[model samples]
Target: MLGNVADVAQKEAVAALQKALQSGDVEGAGKAWQQVINSISDKVKTDCEMYNTNQKVLAQRGYRMLTTEETEFYQKLVKAEKESNARQAFTDLITTNGGMPETIIEDVYRELTEEHPLLNKITFQNVKYLTRWILNDHTKQSAAWGNINDEIKQQITSGFKEIEVTLYKLSAYAVIPQDMLDLGPTYLDNYIRTILKEALYVALEKAIICGSGKNEPIGLNRDIHEGVDFNSSTGYPEKTPIKVTSFMPKEYGPVVAKLATTESGRLRTFDEVLLICNQIDYLTKIMPATTVMTAAGTYAKDLFPFPTEVVRSNEVKTGQAILCLPEEYFMGIGGNKDGNIEKDDSTKFIEDARVYKIKMHGNGRPWDNTVAIVLDISALDPAYFVVRNDADVLTA
Candidate 1:
């Protein structure tokens, strides 16, 4: 009967401690701590008293109390109770804060970066609504004479073009069953972070391929206007539809040279350019056996000045490659404006689920028209930078 009563008392003591911790009642917690200690002491006292009585009753039979062992055990039990209370107090303090546990956050961040390499490669800027840049026109200069020529030349002024880019809000959310939150901090963190990261990556890939002009940023395919036709016999409906049939290594040099001479010559070296294409085009067309090796025994990969970045997406067509200057790609990310994670628990009563919503505001575009060139691999004149593939191709 004493053991059963003591068990009930210990359970009540633990419940009180938990209630105090949840309510953040420091004074109540202290009282609960004392109660827990007293409960454990009572149990130890009862056990010692029963042992003593048994020893006395069986003294002639050589029964002993073993008081030293009982004392050590009681001390150990008290120490364990104190340690458990301290841990519970710390956990309560952390939960009271809106922040997640450090270990969970760290693990989520690591997994996100590993899964999406583009997140690291792309530059991000923090701003409120929009980011702007001033593009200067190319200056024209007249020849100067040693002698103050008969007439003084008129002063020429250079003009500047302003590009204003507005931010686009990308959001992803998940409805988690309320019971899932009870699965511990690490499980909850992983579930939420994984969903959010997947949404972010999806938004990024779309922006890279088909961002709407002004409303969003123009993507590489949309920015290119020049289209070359590889099969002249089967002419395309439009001169430049941002589509092509095949690719060859021999055409790389001439195309790069044409891009280098755009808008007062923006490109200096081929090494400064990046070729972005779909993985299918890269494998079946770009890196063919004929292009991979040369008679001189040099690998084609080593000889190319520009590196290729293969992105897996349905946005990019099968035979198109975008040549770009990484430095000219501008991306602006707004941190605290519309970019925030909102928790919606109003549906808890109806659906028994918590909806976590996150919105990320960002905008990206090429700094100038000459920053990127789309190559229609199938066409003879594969190199194109201007947004006029339907019109006649301009000679460099």
Candidate 2:
């Protein structure tokens, strides 16, 4: 799948350049040519910088250098492994420390954002045990604020309420070969990160979109309020999809108006927005609908009436799409809890390897129901670039 291809932007631009050159539109071909050059330049610069980042170095010290106290903490861990069986000693250290160290949690988060485009766009926090904050109840509003009366004072407090964000047990497990564990903290650290991030990239992406709130994060596509459309199989809430036939600006403006405000009808800054769809839908539905030729004549990918950025998540079903401000989604997956790793009794492992279960505490959801809009885009119009017979100008 092109969605799974590496160096995506560069590859896509190169493809577009080839298509543009074939179209015989000199102006569009030139723009596509420029885009190809730019994409390659950026890709090389990014790839070069990443080459210097050694996983072993990061696994030992951390992405952000460990604090003196934390460094000493590891030094003591090294001291604790005086026994010949370093693997057993390390296991004991993990048990004593809750589960995995906070460093691994932080590392996995960094990897998630770096590797996953969906994660990179949203608001993520490494919150503590419990982080309580105030969320204004957009359903309620204060009375007239000009006069300070008893009614006004009483009404003021109704507009907001406090919510406590706490962690829940999101369980996962990883298997490491005995040799790797014997290599001590560095190898274990790297393996733990690999398994954790791979697990989370799929799990979190699915949960953030359609997860039922039963022992998991409430999804952005699900209703925030209680007693909504419930799916018994998965315990997921189903949002009513807005029906739309085309994404052209003339037809697009009003369909997205509902998304340009707070639940309380307050206006929002719309510099950029996120659009998510499954890989199949993106290639067949969204790309045809959103890709438009520019004044320069080169085709643009995923351009919408409002500025948009596209991120693919197979979690989103085919024929459906999600629109929202990326920053409006809130997610926090903190390992700074009473965490621990234990043997998976259910798994019968061979003598060469051992599988361990790791429990992490984390929570995530949209800021509110209004932030995300699910759309029925099965009938979306395909874009076409046409030159007017009378006017010399081209249009998409």
Cα deviation at 386, candidate 1, in Å, is: 37
Q: Count the backbone clashes (under 3 Å) in each candidate.
A: 5, 4
The runs of at least 3 residues in candidate 1 whose Cα sits more than 4 Å from the true structure, single-residue gaps closed, are 1-114, 117-119, 129-162, 184-186, 224-250, 262-272, 289-312, 345-351, 378-396
**In angstroms, how far off is 120's CA in candidate 1?**
4.0
Model 1, CA-based lDDT: 0.50
- For residues 260-375, could you state the per-residue lDDT of candidate 1 as single tens digits? 65465433444545666666666655555224433344545412534555444444555666766655566676543322445554655487655556666777765555666666
lDDT of 2 by residue, 1-396 (tens): 321233577557555654454455778855665455445434333433453356564433233445554455455455544457655665666666555566657778887898789989877886766666566645545456465543534445465657776566766555544455344344334445555665566567877887677777777788765446656576666688998888777777776777777766666657777889988888988888777666566776777777778898767877899987778778876654345455542353455555567667778877777788899988887765542433453432
**CA shift of 61, model 1, Å:** 62
Clashing pairs in 2: 98-339, 98-340, 99-339, 99-340
TM-score for candidate 2, please give it.
Answer: 0.70
- The models' CA-based lDDT, in order, is 0.50, 0.65
Clashing pairs in 1: 225-387, 225-388, 225-389, 226-389, 230-378
Find the 10 residues in a row with the least total lDDT in model 1.
Answer: 230-239
Query: For every model shown, what is its TM-score relative to the native structure?
Result: 0.52, 0.70
